[model samples]
Target: MAVDPDKAVLQELARRNPGEPFVMLNLLRFAADGRASYEEYSRRAAAFLRQYGGELLYAGDGNEALVAEEGQAWDAVLLVRYPSREAFSRMVTDPGYREISRLRSRALAEAVLQPTTPWTRRAG
Candidate 1:
């Protein structure tokens, strides 16, 4: 039930190719009656996202998993792209953004924030 990133997580992210763009995959499981709070958090977070050169590529509620172990389905999924890992790290640590982050923490019982690197495609 990790609702927020810890120091080690942020440190690791900063240690990576800090200037490389990346997409973050968010898997969220809400607490009871948590959706409303999360919605508010999303609204407030948009400004910070924009300020940090982040974009919301996709967001959708989860449906039947089709293939997963029991209890594996999430309540929602979000894909957010950032210009660089450093930008993301900065955004999350900003004092202003930190104020509204409580809404996100309270809204989720569990969450997964995984950063992904795009694979280079070969020309045909």
Candidate 2:
């Protein structure tokens, strides 16, 4: 249940982007009574996210999964799209955002933050 990204992860994310838009998929496992704190975090984090060309595509409590393994169910799901990986990295690394990140840390027992790229047909 790693909530924070390390230097290595940031480095890899930085290396991979060519300025293309990317979406982040977040799967959250909240601790007891963690939802309120997470909501607060989200409310405050929205400004910082927007400053870096990021948008909250969706954020909602997770419902029954049509398919999943045991222990794979998440409490909430969040989808955010960023103009680029650099923008996202900068947003996370910003001092203002860092200050408010504690709320997110306190709210989740486990979480998944994955970057997704849109698919396109390849030319033959």
Candidate 3:
């Protein structure tokens, strides 16, 4: 597949909105026994998010820079920034997303979603 650098840039811009209410949906897939089909799932998930207006500020498999200290502990780490909280919710529940849910579930033994609000610094 041809990689659209423009799309990636736009997505990254959207994702890097520092003051926005971003949700860090950390998916901790249960795969302690063995490795899941993370590579495939990660590719698909990136494509899926790009279809919408999502920027991937960060992506790694533990060993990469900016990743957690306890690297390799997770099969994957994805960060997507939406325009709004509702937008995030709708994206998950959307018909298009419904199909991808299976891909997500199948790739991991289990998972976790951790939503967070991006901290904003006020000008003095």
Clashing pairs counted in every model: 0, 0, 2
Candidate of highest TM-score: 1
Could you tell me which 10 consecutive residues in candidate 1 have the lowest summed lDDT? 1-10
Candidate with more favorable, higher TM-score: 1 or 3? 1
Candidate number with the higher TM-score (1 or 2): 1
> Candidates' TM-scores?
0.96, 0.94, 0.58
Q: Is candidate 2 or candidate 3 better by lDDT?
A: 2
What 10-residue stretch in candidate 2 is worst by lDDT? Answer: 11-20
RMSD in order of candidates: 1.1, 1.3, 10.2
Q: List where candidate 1 sits over 4 angstroms from the true fold.
A: 122-124
Q: State the lDDT of candidate 3 residue by residue for 38-71, as single tens digits.
A: 5555566676566656667776664344655653
Residues 1-124 of candidate 1 have per-residue lDDT tens digits of 6889998989899888999999999999999999999999999999999999999999999999999999999999999999999999999999999999999999999999999999899999
* Candidate lDDT values, in order: 0.96, 0.91, 0.55
Global CA lDDT of candidate 2, please? 0.91
- Write one digit per residue (lDDT tens) for candidate 2, span 1-124: 7977787898789778648789999999998999999999999999998899999999898998889998988999999999998888888899999999999999999999999998999999
lDDT score, candidate 2, position 78: 92
Residue pairs in steric clash, candidate 2? none
| lDDT at residue 103 of model 2 (Cα atoms) | 96
Better of 1 and 2 by lDDT: 1
Model 3 Cα RMSD, Å? 10.2
